[model samples]
Target: MNTQDRLIESTRELLWERGYIGTSPTAIQRRAKAGQGSMYHHFTGKPDLALAAIRRTAEEMRAKAEAQFSVPGTAVERVTAYLRRERDVLKGCPIGRLTQDPDVMADPVLRAPVDETLAWVRERLTSILAEGRERGELDVAMDPRATAATIFAVLQGGYVLARAADSVEPFDQAITGVLGLLTASTPATRE
Candidate 1:
């Protein structure tokens, strides 16, 4: 691969492993097998390289979600399916992980892709829920956006729990718990 391409891939991989704070230019250069001069020749600095990586990851995540989120199915069926989709619960959501990173969260440019990607995912799921409400599959009173955000939160939180417990059991339990809430109706569960 070209130096620029190699640099971007390296950043993506590094960010996944160490996040923004831990990924250094030297490390990136080493991973890419490019020199410091070569990296600087293509990008301004770590932030610039991170932006490219974040954007690439964002697009990839969106595409993956669209595959399942936009498919034909009931809201519960789709949301549940989307949640239950195979994931590296230990590695966690790459974009979601950025939310916990001090550096990535500090820079708007660096944070933009992560925020937008997650927002879009929630919105997509919300739209699907809205559709289900129209079909009477999901209660009309349900706040689509809030419900969507809650689902995403549970997912993000599940990653934290699973990582802490060093097992997928917590992740699975968390998902099952969230599904219980999502599937709860009669508007009484809120009480």
Candidate 2:
């Protein structure tokens, strides 16, 4: 890749591996195999480069979710697909992990993409659930907004649970539990 691209990719990796406070410009330059001049020439400083990296990560997350959301399936099916999508579960979420970083959370610029991306996911899920309810696929009493929030919570929480236990089983079990709850709420079809 080009120098700028290398720098951004390196920053993303470093940010994922180390929080903002832990990722230094020197480390990023070292990882990118680019000198200080190359980095400064392409960007103002560490924050600028980090912002670019974070935004890229957030965009990728959205695109991946959109892949599942746009697929041909019922709301629950699409959601299940998203939940079951391949992921580096042990590595945790790139964006979600940032929320735990004090430096990232303290800075509005760095936090914006993380906040917006998560909100978008929840909103998209809510719309899907609402559509399903309108189609009578989901129960009439189901609250799309609430259910969406629950799904979001379980997905993120699963990542934490799995990481804490150093196993993916907790994450898988959490997903299965949530999926079961969703299935149980599906309206029964007439024979």
Candidate 3:
């Protein structure tokens, strides 16, 4: 890869592990094997490089999510497929992780990609929930936006729990529990 490519890749990796505030131009230069001049030649600075990296990661994540959620299946099937999609459970969602970083949130350019990614995910899930409600697969009283946000929160919260416990069991249990709640709420299946 070129100097620019090397720098961007290194930035993404460092950001993944240490976040925006923790990553520095020196660190990225060292990781990329590029000189300070070469690094500066490609990006204005660390923030600029991180912004590019964030956008790239966001696009990758969106594509990955769409692959499963857009597939031919019922709402439960789609949700289950998305929740069960293989992930670095401990690493968590790339954008989601940034939400916790004070620096990332403070910088408008840095936070844009993270916010956009999360908003897109919630909107996509809301559409799915709406379809389910219409088809009677889900209860009519369900508010698609709120329910989607809740589902999104559960996944994000699950990552926090799993990382805190250093075990995947909590994440697995969380997903399974949601699946049960969603399926069990069908009007026909009411107790």
Clashing pairs in 2: none
lDDT of 1 by residue, 5-68 (tens): 9999999999999988889999999999999999989998888999999999999888888877
Q: How many residue pairs clash in each candidate?
A: 0, 0, 0
Pairs with backbone N, CA or C atoms under 3 Å apart (clashes), candidate 3: none
- Model 2, position 128, has a per-residue lDDT of 95
Residue runs of model 1 more than 4 Å from their true location after superposition: 186-191
Q: How accurate is candidate 3 locally (lDDT)?
A: 0.89
Off by over 4 Å in 3: none
Cα RMSD, model 2? 1.3
* Top lDDT prediction, candidate number: 2
Strongest candidate by TM-score:
2
Q: Between candidates 2 and 3, name the one with more favorable lDDT.
A: 2
Residue 42 in model 3: lDDT:
87
Which 10 residues in a row give candidate 2 its minimum summed lDDT?
A: 182-191
